[model samples]
Target: MGDLVYFLNGRKAEKIEAVTFADLRMQESDIEEILRSSIDMICDDEESMLIVGQQVKNEKNGRSDLTAIDNNGNIVLIEIKRDRKDIEGRKEAFEFQAIRYAASYATLESTEDLVKKVYAPYIEKYRSEFELGVLTSYELLIRKLNEFLRVNKAGKSFNKKQKIVLVASDFDEQTLSAVSWLNSNHVDMSCYKLTPFKVNDEIYLQTEKVLPVTNYEDYYVNLMDKSLATIVKRNKGGTRRTLPKIDSMLDWGVVKEGDVIAVKDRDNEGILLANGNIMVNDKEKSMQSWLKEIYGWSSVQTYVFAIHKESGKSLSQIREEYMTQQAMEASDDF
Candidate 1:
């Protein structure tokens, strides 16, 4: 890592020195506490990851740093360490320790089990931050989990898998190598590097997700840019990305109202309406909802799954053609 510099003026700059947590005399507990309250530091609006509990104890007679449930209802184990020494000095490999903790979550039989075991305590611990009405902590936990699942339309896949996230200021080479192998072998694991910087007496931290997470829901994939649908068989490089909505397709003139769309090999079809909803059985639904239902998944690439009957092509193909044409025209302008 390099220095973090801030420009006070066009010609003047202030260079902030990179510092270790030890340099600032900060304990790993401090980092855990911050992350327990601010998991968003490692996440963005595109994804949802709610930290449910911190220092959660497991049957293994050890306590996990933090636990979260992602939008797709996978319990995420987040373990934090200060540096390379902290990660490698453990009796077990850091990754192995986290994997053991995560394996314990796989035994959860139902969402209710999750509520009773993990989230209920979180509600009580953070009671002041929430508005708990005439309900017990367990009820509040259920409400929170259900509401999160309902809002993201992820109820169907609640707790289907467990994911591990390891955070440390510095990771040893072997740990990263092992994590890479695990991810390739279909283990949902990620490493996030959290570095600290110091300026005068103030210390600041930066977080970055080190490995690109593999797409869990790879039922559909779009090889094109965006705003359309395409389908291909799953392969090793199935990375999930942001997909464009029907509004973008309409803007690009890929498809318009009165057009018919259907999922591959499905006889029943739906009609695209002017308001960007698909009409099925006289009921209107958003393309995302339709796709999710068809795929029976919490996260589905909608545009890829939808086929435009008029063009006999995927909206992905149409959008790809339009982008290519636009790019060619733009080049001719030069």
Candidate 2:
């Protein structure tokens, strides 16, 4: 891992030296406690996950650091290690420990068992966080979990798969190799490198996904777009163009509010609204939520799957047609 660098006072570049957990006198328990409630440190915002259990125990009585239910209806086992030796020195590999707990979670078949085994114990451990005045029975817990699954729109795909996430300050060679091999065989496993850097009295952490190299094309495009926006800000009387959103589609006359959208190859339909949420089965759901729920995909491209009932054209097609007409009207290269 490289030292994290940042601009000091927006004037000179400064290196924030990396430090081990031992140097900070922090233990694995400290990191586990912090991540239990803040799963976003490892997960992206779009991939919704709820931490239903912390220190979840397996059949062998091994306690997992965290257990979560992801939006894709997969049970997620998140295991964290403080430093490199915290993982490499173990008899059983750190990754194997997480995999064992994840396998135990796979044996669960119903939401009731989930509520009893995970959610109930989690609620017990974090009682102050909930408003359970006289509602501490299993009935209430099961009901609440069911409601959560339904409201999240994950009910249809509940327990379809299991996901494994391993986090550490640094990874060992064996751990990296195993995770890569598992991913190649279609196992939904990932690793996150969480490095801590100390700057004076303050400590900051940098997180990176080091395995299964993904395309960063969109990330770079966003950086270039930010640069263009900065140029616009500096130029007098120049304004930055915003990314096209649902409102943009309405303005471009591609689709209107209250238009019915039919999901391709599916019987599902929704009534589009100005706010970008669609009315699906008497409930307002975001276009992306509807798409993700039906497809059981981790991410969704709303416009690609949605078709305007009246025009009989997919949202992507209509958007492209509108852009083509605009380009033809302008007929000039920038």
Candidate 3:
């Protein structure tokens, strides 16, 4: 059956009948409006989520349905599709469109800049309609944006991650398979089905996350982590390394060819390395892998201070000196 059947009180005379978006005269735009106002219906934490932009134009002249940023600074792109009987190839079209938007959004560098441009306009458009007192929506948006930015700056890195969400009345088998494959590979995509029903004058809506089902969410996350770790390890083998530069300031001045260096942490040192190879705790890992293991995210620059057993100076100090020298050399080139 295309509709979900409901019975009242186990065997009551009342019945809840299935309703389509058309029956309610609700368009995709109406659904978008409702979602913009109540995003938490889809995202778990409403307080930490902000609908920054809607109908946002991308670099390729395509407009995205909604753009939001979570407290973690991860950008979320949402696309809405109406699955009507008249529509054909809706699955492929909607999925492909959302993926394209995601690809374009992944290039965004500064979350602050995006907030100022896209979110500012959205707040301005809806400010007068909000009943939340004298504080304009724009002002509140900025306050939330600043708070998120501050917290993210002090904590683990953000703004580099992007997730795509597709909302529709129903998903086809092909679309489900595509989303499943993407989520399995750590692409961070999800599909939510918004089914509508009616019982007399009351209209009820049901939301279900079709992709990466709740029962398997933990398993999926763990699998993705392992897969990422494996990829990092494989890439480490191909990375080029430079000879260890010796500093003469310390008593044990030089870094020996086989000395082990550790990434500092309270419980887990992550990985110990000697001569560009994993020596302890791990089989093959690089600085990037170590950072991912310790911080649960990948950063271009390593945050931990690597220390050599012989030298008193921390790796941070050595890196600072090296950077300073490189800056001086670059000035000469100019």
Q: Could you give candidate 2's per-residue lDDT for residues 104-183 as a string of tens digits?
A: 99898998889888889888877776667777657767776675566457898888899898988887666766776777
For residues 11-120, write the lDDT of model 1, one tens digit per residue. Answer: 77876667788877879999998787656666532456667777888886888888888777788899999987888788889999999899888998787988888877
Stretches off by above 4 angstroms in model 3 are: 1-13, 45-47, 84-87, 90-92, 129-140, 149-156, 214-334
CA lDDT, candidate 3, residue 76: 82
* Ten residues in sequence with the least summed lDDT for candidate 2: 232-241
lDDT of 3: 0.60
List, residue by residue over 1-334, the lDDT tens digit for candidate 3: 1546575776775656567887789998999998886665575311245577889887778899988876567778989877635234444466678889888877766655776667778767766643446665556665656655554452244567888888887765546556666776788787777888887688788776555543322223343244532322233221112213233222233444456565543244433333343344546665444543443222312322355444545555665566678789999999
For the record, the alpha-carbon RMSD of candidate 3 to the native fold, in angstroms, is 18.4
- How many clashes in each structure? 4, 0, 0
User: After superposing candidate 1, which stretches have Cα over 4 Å from the reference?
Assistant: 1-10, 213-334
TM-score of 2: 0.65
Ranking by lDDT: 2, 1, 3
RMSD of each: 12.4, 11.3, 18.4
